[model samples]
Target: MSLARRASAEFAGTALLVAAVVGSGIAAARLSPGDVGLQLLENAFATALALGALILMFGPVSGAHLNPVVSAADWWLGRRAGAGLTVRELAAYAAAQVAGAVTGTVLADLMYGLPAVSWSHTDRIGGNLWLAEVVATAGLVVLVFALARSNRATATPAAVGAYIGAAYWFTSSTSFANPAVTIGRAFTDTFAGIAPASVPGFVAAQLVGGVLAVAALAAWYPQAGRSADAVVVPHLTEETALR
Candidate 1:
């Protein structure tokens, strides 16, 4: 895929991801504030599943890396060969992801009439939250690299979805797997966000998780280094044909 096309795919994918997150958070806030935790769990699981399927579907046409962290991690690990994302592409995608999350949150706010990511999620700090972030992000990155490298999960997108869903309950932070998504969700001011003050901790945990994921993949899936392409095929009408 050309650079332009890849960037476009990343933008659209990230937008969709944000929309799913914010939209679901708003709905949960109004329907069952008490169950917001479960709601986020479900939303994130579904989003990851949807994202994985979408990536598989679009991987051939575009790289389908909706998250800058994914793209950067893949490139750094030598998974992206001919089509690694450049600095400009990463920056653009990150901007789009953040904007998309904020936009989705605003729209949800309008519909739910709850303040966007307000006091409900404020001061929501604890070791569980941090540990959850670490585990969730680690699982997510591990899944991405695993399926892409092993070719087991690439043919079917269910693995990513399943991993995400399970991670939500198993991990704490309702599985805020992606940094971009985490940052974007914060804008919502809903139950899904980590307060601005808490953003740093979350990001640090996520990055560490991502790095650990890469290390784990490198150790467990050595072939990942020479993989044809880092493809996270989404379940779509059009499937990616491997080289």
Candidate 2:
């Protein structure tokens, strides 16, 4: 596929993923008023199902990364083998992912009759939350790459969705494992929003988690790079084939 087409897919896929997350949170809060636990359950369930569907919908087009860290990991781990995205493609993908994320947030807000760009006021900073982000992000990275390496890519949609749903309850940060999504969530003050001030910490912690995951994968799957082209999902192009 052309880079433009692939990047477009990334943009749309990431946008819809964020919409699912932020929109579902809004719906959950309204539907289960005064019940934080129930609201969370509703939000997590919706987001999980949306994620799996989005992946299935766009994976063949752009690998449906929908996350900056996932794209970065695919690039870093596959660089040596020349199997994943090139540096230029990585840059494009990240840009699209972040932009799409913010757009998604706005879309969700508009859908709920809220301000399109309401800055989030929710404070979500703390040691525990940061640690949770690390754990959640690391696990995501591990799961994504491991499945690709082990030739179980087909299971990623269901497996990843199930993992995130579970992590919502298990992690203190509610598992905002994607940097793009985190930044996007800051645009809304609804149930899923994070204060703009808190975005840096969450993003930084996520990056750290991604780095740690990469190191662990190196040790556990030394030859994992050979399968980097298939991370998240397989979408081979003539360009990658030539590489």
lDDT of each: 0.63, 0.93
> What's model 1's lDDT at 2?
47
TM-score of each: 0.79, 0.98
234 Cα displacement, candidate 2 (Å): 0.6
TM-score of 1: 0.79
lDDT of 1 at 197: 73
Cα RMSD for candidates in order? 4.2, 1.2
- Model 2 is weakest, by summed lDDT over 10 consecutive residues, at 234-243
For candidate 2, lDDT tens digit of each residue in 1-243? Answer: 888898999999999999999999999999999999999999999999999999899998889889999899999999998788889999999999999999999999999999999999999999999999999999999999999999999999999999999999999999999999999999999999999999999999999999999999999988778888787988855576466
Cα miss at 108, model 1 (Å)?
A: 3.4
Off by over 4 Å in 1: 33-49, 56-58, 79-83, 86-89, 110-121, 153-156, 234-243
Q: After superposition, how far is residue 56 of candidate 2 from its true place, in Å?
A: 0.4
> What is the clash tally of candidate 2?
0
